[model samples]
Target chain A: MARLSLNQKTTDRWSVAEAVAGCVRAGLPSIGLWREPVQAIGVPTAARLVADAGLRVSSLCRGGFLTAADPARRRRALDDNRRAVDEAAELGAACLVMVVGGLPEGSRDLAGARERMAEGIAELAPYAAGRGVRLALEPMHPIFCADRGVLSTLGQALDLAERFPAEQVGVVVDTFHVWWDPDVLGQIRRARGRVASFQVCDWITPLPPDALLSRGMMGDGHIDFPLLRRAVEQAGYAGDIEVEIFNAEVWAADPDAVVATLARRYVTHVLPD
Target chain B: MARLSLNQKTTDRWSVAEAVAGCVRAGLPSIGLWREPVQAIGVPTAARLVADAGLRVSSLCRGGFLTAADPARRRRALDDNRRAVDEAAELGAACLVMVVGGLPEGSRDLAGARERMAEGIAELAPYAAGRGVRLALEPMHPIFCADRGVLSTLGQALDLAERFPAEQVGVVVDTFHVWWDPDVLGQIRRARGRVASFQVCDWITPLPPDALLSRGMMGDGHIDFPLLRRAVEQAGYAGDIEVEIFNAEVWAADPDAVVATLARRYVTHVLPD
Candidate 1:
């Protein structure tokens, strides 16, 4: 319970202030934020709101989508990521989660997309580090590989992260994305000091029409959460374990009820020890 | 064109006889068979139909689902796989593509399920080898890890395959499955002598509601088909390139048109050289 955090996505209807208030009501120690909501109230006010509520900001939702082949779009993406880094710094977020972009429109060049992703990261890592924000690369599921993320494995995330200092570039171990990797336990072990964030969510089946919202609550799916939790703990990730889910039903539910449910699930399914 | 083989699922509307006749009409030298339709007419007759058409059986549709934890259910799964092996042998399939089962109805023990999958393969591999049929373990896309194939990566499939004699057990490299793997090229290189089957299909986005039927035609999606095709070719897989798609739209279309479109896509998208 002490280490539990409520990621904003879990209570999708909540704004920055609303999520912070919900976290405080739930007695959660922290909250993970998204760029849009934080920027909505402006980062300074959002930062002071969380600080006043006595909550830690676990992470900033995202900052990557750098796989543009077009030079103008690529430059704009890098600039946007730099702004994201500044936002993370202002919010005092632990890290900026990076959901590296998928293939460019009408493009079949995956290798090129991936190479551009790496280059974007390389360009952003130093800027992020200078702003006191770590870039946490989120290795999304293979299902999202065609449209959302090119980094499909934790090992692949680590490959890019390893190019920079651990404090500058790290990987986010989101269970929903990585629970199916055969070498996940090994990859978690390899993550070691570079694990910037640990997110808990279940990978549910009979996926919704929109696959992006497919993440289920921990107890409702097939993931061995305790096994992964133990592995992450053993890998030396002692930070807040954020419960992040992106399900339409969850989004439609009462934000407070969503937080309460995730809080309970975090105890029973994520932190049994 | 010489290596092109129309997987039965690609032409979903076609019966075994119809698919074989379609293959003959398309001037395709081979056809991949599925158990349901083959068993509809029985194996012996199905075998003769293809033989009579002078079409080689590239590989049988499947022969796995071996991850049951219950002893009785496990035994049944192994027996079903053995029958599939015999059918593959009778049809003279190049190999038996195995879509290994997912988690049991209510179980979360992926490691346990994987162990049982290996044990089942160990039990069936020798029987398959004796019948001159190789068990080509198909590492399905991670999207299907919970409900379909627990084997999610080609490297993971090879890990299971290398534990057995290559003649008894090998792997199926489906482009749609392994395309997202970061280590896929290296894994293919590692799969040199053990490549039993090479399946090709495009992975499209805004995946259909079923998710299972999300695969698109060759040029209809974002996959770099030529890249994967070249990787398999360099892996020394001199086998039939079976185009296996599972889209509802493709299924509803004319089977002959599907075959003709795939034939053109195979040349332009798959084997540009």
Candidate 2:
């Protein structure tokens, strides 16, 4: 009954079949899928699996690494993203989340890298729109700006998203990424109707040796989930609330247990009163 | 000779006396001191040492951790900051760099924490100005916003600094922290007269296990130093270009060797042509 969705990465061990069944067993209405697992099972089979279980594919986890320096690589990235759009449409995903790539290897031209990301998005937006799939620009935390994502703020993501039609391109309000932004609330409000997805996770301190795994369970860290949830709701986002945590400990835990814990945390800490 | 200053922490192994002497030996005209080392050698003695070496104290490394939940601790923080002001004045440093503390322990009220920082700065500004020391608000990278400093953007720092007179308050344009900020160039331009100090370091990826030790030498990471240097110079900030790296490897190297490498990198990668 709680409109909570589990992002596949949160349960790293779960295969496409396992994750779909786990969501059904956990009574989760939706699941956010990654292209890897879905591709591993083949898109049509994966789509049928989720549909047969009567589960919504909340959003596809990623389709952007568009900042490569090589022309061939950039072209390949665009081509691959087009395939991801088709996959999202086949799966009936609400959006295709993008983790825009960081600086090209050994290059420090952040502006140039950002320009490349915008260009990639601009070229892909029409293709995605044609298939009725939205492009969700997930501005990662600034710490990941060097290698993970060049889009470092919701404002920046919105700046790019605003250039496209709201249904074609929008921004993701991932708490782990935008909670530290002083202007996040304003950006969230500004992103009204352009919010393609809302993801939840907590930010733990003394980050892991690998910064990528620093996201904790919703209630385990400093993020005020209810506060963020309220902001997203006020921004006109009445969509599946995806719990996307990436941590070694979380991944090591049993997938069903992780889903149960996420559901409980969502009701307790994230659902608005 | 360029307007370069060697921040002592870049050569973490050097004593206060040795750092001053090393700066002089390296033909560096200025040195930035940390309060711990200056207090270790006694402020007066450290001041005299730098004076004897014909070295200017570019800026003192910090004087703000005011985001405390407890009233008594807040008062103590203000007291310690006052002492830091006295030290900066005694050492004839240009400013007292403030890395305003992050969320108070067990507290998640980021807005409250940032308010505490602003209040602390407002309370300390007059005291610092009275002693002829400017308060340099250093906006740290957003990654450190949870535990180290909540001031995560130059724009946020300036928003706070603009509250006080420019002589009493200013912002530090540290390359390592602000390079990931998309609007950094515009913020630097806006920080014109209030640009208290300009610090340089690189942002290498796969950050060290201890995030605090991740600052790399100028040429070793992804920052466009000359680009930043040009922005600062265009902002009318004719101040010492301090090389303040915080890497464990850099700290382990010989202090003289570290200083020598920093000087060379400053010329090759940082100094605007």
lDDT of 2 by residue, A103-196 (tens): 9989989999999999999999999999999999999999899998999999999999999989999999999999999999999999999999
Score candidate 1 by lDDT.
Answer: 0.91
Model 1: colliding residue pairs: none
What's the distance in Å from true for residue B231, model 1?
Answer: 1.6
In candidate 1, what are the lDDT values of residues A1-273, reduced to their tens digit? 888999998887888888998888989999999999888889899999999999999999889999999999999999999999999999899999999999999998888899999999999999998999999999999889989999999999998899899999999999999999999999999999999999999988777778988889999998889999899889998999999999999999999888889888888888775
Worst 10 residues of 1 chain B by lDDT: B202-211
The candidate maximizing TM-score is 2
* Candidate 1 residue lDDT tens string, B91-119: 99999999998999999999898999988
Per-candidate TM-score against the hidden true structure:
0.98, 0.99
Model 1 Cα interface RMS deviation (Å): 0.9
